[model samples]
Target chain A: MIQYDKISSRDAFGNALLRIAEENPLLVGIGADTTKSMGMQKLSEKYPERVINIGIAEQNMTAVAAGMAATGFQVYAASYAPFSTLRAAEQVRTFIAYPNLDVKIVGGLGGLSGNIEGVTHQGLEDVAVMRSIPNMTVVIPADAASTEVITEEIARIRGPVYLRLGRGAVEKVFDAGYRFQIGKANVLKADGSDAAIICNGAVVARALRAAQLLDANGVKARVIEMPCVKPIDADAVVESAAATGAVITVEEHNIIGGLGSAVAEVLGGRRPSPLLRIGIEDIFTESAPHNDLLDRYGFRPEDMAARIGQFLSSFNSKNEEEA
Target chain B: MIMKSSVAELREAARLIRRDIIDIAYLAEGPSHPGPALSIADILAALYFRVMDADPRNPGWAERDRLVLSKGHACPAVYAALAGRGYFDRAWLTTVRRLGSRLQGHPDMNKTPGIDITSGSLGNGLSLGLGIALALRLLRKNCGVFVILGDGELQEGMIWEAVMAASAQKADNLTAIVDYNHFQSCGGTDEIVPLEPMRAKWESFNWNVFEINGHDMEEIVSRLEMAKRFTGRPTVIIAHTVKGKGVSFMEADNSWHQRIPSKEQYDTAMRELAGGSE
Candidate 1:
């Protein structure tokens, strides 16, 4: 098992941006009244001239970032996930993605992580929106270390990117030895093939914990952590479907068009298999503490493990009886 | 890098650009915004011929001034200017708005050589120009950015946001040209969302405002030159123009906003524009 550390993904992104600023003098940060909350305040403090605050305008922020990027400057637009992805959806699509400019749209407060702030602040549909747009590379880091890694990699990629981040510290899912490729999936546990848990963002650690519980129950399962949601690792998904025959996808977004939908699209195209989508179903969640919301949504490790166990055993027993 | 085009020279160029706008629209075999494109012929002529310090041989030359046609539907005029400037072959004008052509219906920076930024969606060009202007300032390059916004496009809420931000940044390197052509897709802008006391709106936003008759060859060139040198804040030139200046039937007519001219109408437009030739 890999050891875990507690660090806010937003802070990790902010610090990585500072490092990027140190190297890239032309790096510009554009925000819409979300500098401090979205991890851009430090960059503003350090390089006042570099950070161009656009007040409370999200659409203007995204379009302006595209403009800056077109002018040959490395640009990042930060805001709440909903505002950055949906509110500025057309600007991101037309100006940034259509031209394929190298602008990273960093959206904070993804999913139920901002639970206390209610549905308005929560970014439940952002992943779905970003992934659907053509030429947009969608990324959701599992933790601080991975956020830093993805941020560094995103700078090198010469196209538009959407970096979805959550509020507060998340459980670490990787170590110093961990490797991150933009479009490859990382297998945290490959011990068993009874079931495969494919997950991303703040839920990868929970998926790992659930796999451990399945192991204790004498059931071997594989756990895959996917960070790059767009240009997804189709090979990993196909292999997992072939090995386990039962795939479970977990996320902190709407189940309709996120990791579940993306994985299903890959599997339905190549490898047909039984799949279970675990996330916020097609319903708006109410305000609560983040952890309580997780538990309430059946995203707790123990709850997820029980569901996985029931799914595999029930399906297998039916096959056995039929045989 | 320098070409001083006199008023007579600019008038001839504007006449040819007007002819190209009609040619591009008539050749498209579909409805195109000949009205909007015709309105900005003189403005683009002034900028391309005299105002902007851009090299036609090298579209991506560093330190060269940039123009973002925020009102992208007027790309026919811009395409005519770029082709006239030798950015591409004049023969390509026949293939405009056609498949595999670099001159798309809307301005695309990647597909076209001289386009500085891709813009079609309204209220976006000003912010894009501000970004370029800000970057040019940071690099200490004296390159200016010019953005053309339609009168109807000014209704977009985001335009005001950019207008406010541009002033707050004190981006003196940027200049906005409002083609106050009096019409949008549906009808006259005054009949829809009236932006009357136009100069006050920009002045209240802390911009350097200049209103001029957009079709006047001398006034268009001189005022644009003045705006190029104005400093301390962003500038906006509200160039009052008829929607279809050269074509009498289309001018100030709401029905011809994006409608392409029939063969007979095209011939009249061609003859009228050609008559202004020295």
Candidate 2:
């Protein structure tokens, strides 16, 4: 059993932004009538003038943030995930990504964490949209600790970044002193050789627990945490796939375009390993409790463990038949 | 710093920019939009020559005013003005839209030295300008931002969002110049989308509205300067202009909106623009 702390990545990021603003006078925040809901309440309270609530206009907020970035301000444009990515899609691509502005596009309530709000609010396809845009650095921190570190790290990056954050208190994957770097994946558990569990965002800790369960069942699996979705750790992915001979990618997003596609792009005929992708399988999710949604979507620890176990058992059976 | 030029000098500058536009169109390996470019030449001449305080030597001067060419297709006009104002060499103007040239079909702030924001996608430029104005105000920097808009571009929903937000924030340091050339890529804005009651619309939105002849060099300069003094709300100058102002065959013609001039047409335009001040 692993100890877990519930910390919302959005809150951690907001707190880190407030702390960062203390020294950097040019830091500006743009909100789409979500200053409080998006975790910028504390920052707004402390420095009310720094945050501009654009009042439910996500597209305008994005371009406004891009404009602010042109003036040398490290800017953050925060809105709900669906509206930020889908509704304001062209603005992000045209104003920020094409220009390579230093504007950080923050989307709160990523994935099933916006479960109670249903498909309208959830960001099941944000990573896909963001990854497809040129010059966009996509990041989804595993937990609050990683989120805090990533927020600080990406602030120093003088280019466009999309930092997706979840709504609920996510199960903490890293401890207090976790170090993070953009485009690098961290291996949490390396004692396994049967297969590797590569995941990002809040699902990282669940992947670790699934790995632990795999260990108990005499099936060893490696757990790798991939935070940066774009500029991915292709070297780690190739090596891990080559070492374990199999790869399973877990994300809180659509399996079609998120971590799975990224990994597949990296392993395109080079590794030639069997790949299994687990996520919200290209369907709209109904409103429910966050954990129930996770469970239904096959993101729970036992669900992943069972699925990986079945897949491995089938692979072994095929190999035995070949032998 | 502001270039202190007389009205005659500014008119001469506008003619030169118009000539530059014709030159680029003639040099084009493909078709280009010379209609919108021709309309905004005088306005760009007024801003770069006498009204706006910007430095060609230091394009990134923190204190200098910035221009967001919101209607980015009119960049041929902007490139002409920037070249005339010494942002870059006049040689690059001939290389417009050419492969590997810094003068792209649209304005790119990174590739080009003096472009404040990369704009071409309409209805987003005003917000970009508002953002810069708000930022400069926060830093207590005495600066202004000019956003050049197309009348048809006003039909975009995001433009109204920026318009309302700018007034609500009381962004007095921001100015938006609508090149009301009465035409867009397709047809006349009045006939197509019809942004009529235009003045009342902006006034209702609480902007300091000023109507001017966009082709008038002195009126353009004075209205731009007055925008800086007008406080408590953002200023918008709606300048009425012709689609293609100078040449006889192109004036008020929708056919010329996005058409690159043919060799004979280019020679005719150069001749007309050369014999200026009618």
Candidate 3:
């Protein structure tokens, strides 16, 4: 089992950005007074000449980053999830995405990670808004280790990509040795019988635990970690459906236009399956602790397990009824 | 590179742009602000013809300067200047707002070669130009980014946000030219939302201010050159101009904001423009 650590992911991103800044003179970092929050302070401190602190202007920061990118600088505009994605969304759409500029929007506090900050700060709608724009790559790394891997991957890629990291603590799901390719799903546990619980980001660990509970009950649950939501690996999804006949998508993001929706779109087009989406119901969240919010929003291991059980029973009943 | 163009040449180009604006207004289903286009023709000519270090052969060159038409409704004037600049073939001007044409009602950066940003939503170009200027500064490239703001477009809060950011950053490479046509879509700016202290507003935001006759090609060209030459502060050129400059009947007329001229009016406007210069 890979060790999970939030600080580790933060360190990976910070260290990678610093190293990239040092090596690539074209790389410039801009933060909206969240260098410490997003772990960009290391880069900011090390490369003070290259980093720009725009105080609290997320919109201007994003637009300036796009401008810097246009001038041949590899720019990373970092900020809190809500303000960075939604507040400067127009800049992201026109200046960055529409022009397909080489600017990386690294948003901290994805999903309910900013739990203490409440609904106003929680970036539950980031994915939904970002996915609507054309020519955008969206990635949610499951852990800190994956964060480092994906950061390096994005640094090398040419187009616009949104790399979202969570707040508080998160588990590490990869190591220095683990290789990651963009747009490819990672199969954590593979078994053919019961059902496949496909998940991303913080929900990966919860889905794994749910799969383990199902395995004890003679239900061979396969858990897959789909880190990249856009350009989703359709073949893996189709294969999982063919094997299990029932698929459940779990994520910390809302039910609309996120991982679950992307997976459902693929499955709907190719093969029909009994799909149960496990995420926030269509409702705005109130202030609560991280764990409390997850539980309240149906993101706990028990929640996924119960949803999978219901889906399995429903799939069997439907088959029997058809027979 | 030294730019040496005569006033007569610049005025001729402005007159041709005015003619093109009237022509395009007629083509656009008789629903365009032809008068506003005529008003800004001289300033647009000064920039596209005499100022702005841009190459028609390579519009997107890394070291080349940038120009953004923040007052986007006056696009007929811009299209004329761009055609004159040879950024695209002059024939494309006839395809303005037509299907599958680079020329749209407003400038689309993706479609037009010389256009810097897609601006139809008013009060956005200043901020967008700020981004471009900031990028040039970050890259440490010696180039200027100019944005032409309408007197009415200043009603947008984003423009002030950009103005503050530019002043705070001391983005000397950037310059904003307010058409100061003294009118908006509704009516005269003072009658609608008074900005009598327009120069003070920009000066308070920490910008170097220069007010001039926008219709004067010499003044327009000289002030733009000065804005590009000077450093350590962002500059604002508040050019006082008539809304429907060359057209007698439409000048300062609010109805001319988006109305296309009738055949009789077009004939008279064409005669006036043609009678002036080229």
Error of 2 at A63 (Å): 0.8
lDDT per residue as tens, model 1, A4-32: 55668888888889998989998988889
> Model 3 chain A — which ten-residue stretch has the worst lDDT?
A1-10
lDDT of 3 by residue, B153-178 (tens): 88877677778888888889999999
Using lDDT as the measure, the top candidate is 2
Q: List the residue pairs that clash in candidate 3.
A: A4-A171, A4-A172, A5-A172, A9-A144
Compute the lDDT of residue B156 as modeled in candidate 3.
Answer: 75
Model 2 chain B lowest lDDT segment of ten:
B25-34
TM-score for every candidate vs. truth?
0.97, 0.97, 0.94
lDDT score of residue A99 within candidate 1: 93
TM-score of chain A of each: 0.96, 0.97, 0.96
Q: Which run of 10 residues does model 1 chain A get worst, by summed lDDT?
A: A1-10
Q: For every candidate, what share of the true interface contacts is present?
A: 0.75, 0.85, 0.37
* Model 3 per-residue lDDT tens digits across residues A69-97: 76677888889789989999988887788
**Model 3 residue B87 distance off true place after TM-score fit, in angstroms:** 1.5
Candidate 3 root-mean-square deviation in Å: 2.2
Judge candidate 2 against the unseen true structure and give its global Cα lDDT, from 0 to 1.
0.89
lDDT of 1 by residue, B171-237 (tens): 9989999999878898879989998989999999999999999999889988888888999999999
CAPRI quality of model 1? medium
